[model samples]
Target: MERPPARTPEGSRKTPVTSGLAARAHRTFTPPELIRNFCIIAHIDHGKSTLADRMLQLTGVVEERAMRAQYLDRMDIERERGITIKSQAVRLPWAAPGRDGKTIDHVLNLIDTPGHVDFTYEVSRSLAACEGAVLLVDAAQGIEAQTLANLYLALENDLHVIPVLNKIDLPAAQPERYAEEIAHIIGGSPDDVLRVSGKTGAGVKELLDKVVAEIPPPVGDADAPARAMIFDSVYDIYRGVITYIRVIDGKITPRERIQMMSTRAIHELLEVGVISPEPIPTVGLGVGEVGYLITGVKDVRQSKVGDTITSAAKGATVPLGGYRDPRPMVYSGLYPLDGSDYPLLRDALDKLRLNDAALTYEPETSAALGFGYRCGYLGLLHMEITRDRLEREFGLDLISTTPNVVYRVTMEDTTTHVVTNPSDWPSGKIRDIVEPIVRCTIISPSEYIGTIMELCQSRRGSLGGMDYLSETRVELRYTMPLGEIIFDFFDALKSRTRGYASLDYEEIGMQEADLVKVDILLQGEAVDAFSAIVHKDSAYGYGVSMTAKLRELIPRQQFEVPIQAAVGSRVIARETIRAMRKDVLAKCYGGDITRKRKLLEKQKEGKKRMKMVGRVEVPQEAFIAALSTDSAPAAGKDAKK
Candidate 1:
């Protein structure tokens, strides 16, 4: 086999001589030997996971046929749903075959991250762990909002980005257009972008070669006091916290005593390992390597993400780079659907907390849902992932309420309080309340600008600026309160743009504004967790939609219910769910009494799975489905109708 002669494209209008776009900035470069670290990032459904599977196969980490969908995203929801919920790391062995067909060993540490806006934090976490990134832009879609978001994060981390336009097998793939977009967006020479089809394995080798050539190796004093940056963590049923770290400056071995800088906790290493796809023995991992460090830390609480691992004997670099505690902006309450499983819910959460440091929970009691835990997350996706994990992994049924963000409010006594639970909201507040705001970037085709702007304006979003990507493409920036976009902004953007719009947002800061946490009442009682801090202007419209969605979401029950949205003791919008006029009352079969009781028990169990929004009980799936592009509009329209 011979290397294909590389052809370079000169300008934006360069005609391709081969079947695909030509490579740019082609040069012979020294490949790193001691270290290799890179991230696989792309838009949703753009084959990041499939390419990861190919890398594993080419590296002999896993047999070809065994590779499955989203293998690195091993969670049941991720695998089944075909979306990455968490970032995963795997170390593969690549070899350059000699002329005699022999092989020389090299290492490739790959971090696979989710591409959705909901998981942007996870992408940032993964980017911080790597020195290089592989940007996979869909050939048909060109550069999307999330593609730019991930690329910007990589550039912020000073990581060398090797852009690869993927999905070349499709008939509509415009590789040349995407390549130019990549160069323009990243400010890199167009010749440096690699074109590949992750599905058919075309040009994948060239992409691999570029990874080895373009990405730099780790450089640090190997003999220095041991220090590592915790990027990700997993919990083992038998073992404790299995922390994933990149040995930044020194070597760590099994039984090594280490201190975590964030928590200041001490622990002894129990074992060390790497991701082989199949169980592989631990060969000593040194500086620049990515692997797992198992510790007898009792609980996963001791080993947290962004925490520093250093030698206990001699304190290492006082503070490591990329160490920041994750603050969860969205919070909700989680309770057992069935009252009998209350203890089971607690036990499952405690177990999950051992591995998932992102999820934070505390004891809370709800009048209708009974004993439960109030949980916090980085965003909506983070909250949903935890709930899905609880139900799928531990086989425990859970009831989760509508997510709410923390609000800073002044009381009548002139004291400031951070209110998370709506129950903590003051009944007769007279001073002021503030809500978190975020800077959002939306990318879409120019044709949908009108619809996008109109939708945003209706949601209380203020436009910042609009920049042209090309003649027909544009990027819109807005500074909107997180409260305004938390509900259906993303869904609306996708709907208005026909699934072509992409959105990314980062928390700007909390702002002093006219906002109130309006309580939603279903009957007479308040569902404190369903309360939201909203602007006064849109309160009535949002409230109407809120109850309309609630009416559709709540199951028909034995009792009639009134769904009321209230602000400062006044009802702005209301809806009533009529009581079930017909329910299975009597059984005609001779032995059906036991069967009828079982069916009723199932119905009760189903009712238990709903969230008590004020007095209205809404199903849990309704919350997840509310984020879709289609149903969200129905929720809005039904409210006023």
Candidate 2:
């Protein structure tokens, strides 16, 4: 094979390729052989996962007939909910070897990351693993908030950016207008934007070719100490922790010993393979190759997403720069719907937490709810998934508290404590308490600007700045507390703006804010499980609404239930659950009476499944749904959370 001459400049060696058997023979490329490691990034429902499916089909990674929308997001929750919760990887052949006898196949490594603003951390982690990004923008919803946020991060990581207009199959998709907007706002030439319909697989091949042409291949010392970035990970019952990594410097195989640089735990590599929709046969992954490594280590204690996996042989020193510790930003308490299944709920979270680094749990006992978990999540979807997984996967019914944020409080002796439960907060503590703040961006059409501003103001959001994208659309920035935004901000924004508002945010840091504990009292007794931290202004609205929802959720018992909303000693509102008035009202006789009595026994069993907070029987969905609603309840209204 004729070798291409080295283009080494200034006292530099040739391109470092990993493989001991292959000598320093220059590898030839004819446009198609050059692969670009890129990730498709977008906001939730912006069609990133859809585009990925189209790309996989166009590149022959998956059969077109077998393809599903968001094919890369394999989780049941993800498919049902239509969101990408975890970042996934897939390899595809970009083109055939050219007629010049060059291998036309370029292995395009594609990483599909989550688009929800809450999962921005995962998006950033995936970005660190890629050298380029295909920024997918909805043609009708051109350059939404998450797109801009992710685009800025890609630029920050020094990744080559290729903007692609997606979802053009929709009649409303305006590709040219979005292309022009991208050129104006994001500073990319309108000609660089590729228009493709991820649904119909239209114009996808041209986009693939553009990816091969525009993005550069991975460049680094292949012979150097083995180092790879653990961009994402998943836990399998059979294989244990499977980490997705890109080999930056050296080869990795099943026999090689490796170490996670962040955890300092060493392990023997059990298996090494690239991501095929179906698991492929074991193959040695070379430098610049993205693949999976499964070590039979059952404990995901140290192996984390965003951690570095390196060869323990050469003792690599410096760790990757972008390793950010996953912090559970939203905290909530969960109890089993049936008291007997408390253990079942606990075990499910423990197993799920192995794959989900963003999930955290601690033992929590409430006077009203008995034993449960004080669990944490990246956001609301994460919390919902945890709860749903418990019920659906583990066969355990659960009752969860309203989610809260961590508060930094300083004691009299200058000791700092991070508090998730407001009930456990130090009373008369002689110092300050700080809350986590985030830099939020909202992109919406100009028609709903007033409505969005009002919604933000209601949630205590302070506007930082605004930029006009066009005469009819605008991007607004706000620095607000994470606690406020995590709840119903997404839903409320969608509702008020008529589903046109797209939101994205990142944790800026913690700021000292005046936050007070709002408690929900049942029968004049405080329920430690239903406490939250809230800004003074919105406390009444949330507290009163929560009280009303709890009243409706708690089924009619043999005795009446009192539900009260209070901040400290001041009571804002109250609701009552009346006792059952018509229990077994019918009079019966003979064998039918026995049958009716047996049926009543089963009904009692079902009633026992609900948690008794005073005289109220609280249902699971009540706690989950009520936490995110943004409205105050109507007088004498019956509602569920």
Candidate 3:
């Protein structure tokens, strides 16, 4: 391939490219042997992004003048939050000295992944694209729940795991202690763990050297039929859906027709390239290489993550072992604040789904909230970030209901139904109701063990076990109902532990429980949007809190509105929204007793007529305020009482 004119040897951008607007190009493809694919995985705030910054500088893939903190983090939300929500891949060039005393140039395909448990799917997809992982642990903070979780995921994929303790320059750094802890976990000696300071850029060169030497190169049949794995993708308004893929077998080039193995969707490849922190159009991507492909795919759904990409004419016979779909543990109703924005909301979600593959939604309607979609999320944080992106990126005003989990209900005749929305709870169920359960891992200081246990128990969690990561830090395992934790457990856990505790949870099937669907009724009419499914033990508390909250939100109407939270025919709790009073005796203040009596009689008759004719109208703001998670803390307080 011919080099573009006036290009630097490093292939760094010469022209001033706007920040994250478009990828700056770089190129000069290398063979499969010199290519190394790996990722950095750690707990949040453990310096994964900062370390990535240091590597960017060391490799000179992103020049110092243009590079900022978290160069791989392209989203404004990610930069503002100082977190990597999406897994980002970039290609960098390195020249490592070989054992034979010769300097060998290498192509390093580095993927920076999110550490948050909500974005674990992103990490897993990134994992499938690599043959090795750099397990990053904070020297001061030691191993966290996510660090361990991500480590296990890497090991499960049979990838080489390299242990590294970061932040050696911190005042509270305890590299010696954490190195042993990391070694014990990874089945190696403490001396095997590499130490690096991301803040000071200490020991990074050695870490890179270790990566090139220790991690084995990816092996694939170069002459075989073309095959690539679609690990991640983003929707470009100008280019349509751009898929990030890792080539496993054969090579792909521009102008070639390709087929998605899973969906059988075909598109002519418009461009093929590698991201040297930017998209550099390459002649082709060979085996064991990571790059991007532009197929002019408008609908992101057609290019599924974990789907195989192959030549439309001479595709591979079999697809690779793909990823399991990320099951949504939390479900919420996302209604547009304005009714007319419903169509816009759907379109926005569809486009956002291109960038975010884990997002799932279906059309749902509520009498109180109107037209909307019931969206599924991996966790509470995932729900929050996705909603924030929708508002910030697409300019959509979204109102999300309180998060809940799925349930399985069996009827007397043995008919089974899976209920995701509370409003969809089966009415004919007479046998058993089972709710999703999760194995939650909470790591915190030992002093907070009692507080953690108390919080877990309050949420109906059973003690699975407990272990000491160190003398002070302890890991507590609990099996809790997914519904119980999705609402306020994480917030409460953080607050109770003074924000020292880190939590990670994975759904572990379902268990039968005494559960009931609590409905909020306004003047004998059930508001489906405000309904919730709760355990029988906390049914009264949920009902009471919901009714009380609604009473405060819903304005006083012409007729008295009774807000009742009922389970079946039984009303568990009720709050009356009293009617606005009219000063009926104002004209009769100076009149006789008979005149006042007549006025009072007329007023009473009018009240009766109003009650008979008028119905309660719960405003949109009322529904938004009632169903929002802002009521979560209040509900927790009430439930405690």
Candidate 2, residue 117: the lDDT equals: 55
* Local accuracy by lDDT, each model: 0.72, 0.72, 0.84
By TM-score, how accurate is candidate 1?
0.80
Expressed as tens digits, the lDDT of each residue in 31-82 for candidate 3 is 7888889999988889999999999888876656787877778788888877
> Order of candidates by lDDT, top first?
3, 2, 1
RMSD of 1: 11.7
**Tens-digit lDDT track for model 2 on 55-158?**
77665556555666777776687777677777877766655444475745577788899876557777887888788998888887787777788888899999
Q: Kindly indicate the candidate among 1 and 3 with the higher lDDT.
A: 3
Candidate 2 residue pairs in clash (backbone atoms < 3 Å): 96-104, 97-103, 97-104, 625-641, 626-641
Best by the lDDT measure: 3
Model 2: residues with Cα > 4 Å off, grouped in runs: 1-34, 96-103, 262-264, 338-347, 410-417, 429-432, 550-563, 575-641
Q: Write the per-residue lDDT of candidate 1 for residues 175-269, one digit (tens) a residue.
A: 87778877887787777778788778888877776676668887767778888888877665545566788887777777768889878888887
Q: Judged by TM-score, which candidate is best?
A: 3
User: Candidate 3: worst 10 consecutive residues by lDDT?
Assistant: 632-641
In candidate 1, which residue ranges exceed 4 Å CA deviation? 1-32, 96-104, 261-266, 312-319, 339-343, 520-532, 542-565, 573-641
- Estimate TM-scores for all models: 0.80, 0.81, 0.93
Regions of candidate 3 where Cα sits further than 4 Å from its true position: 1-28, 630-641
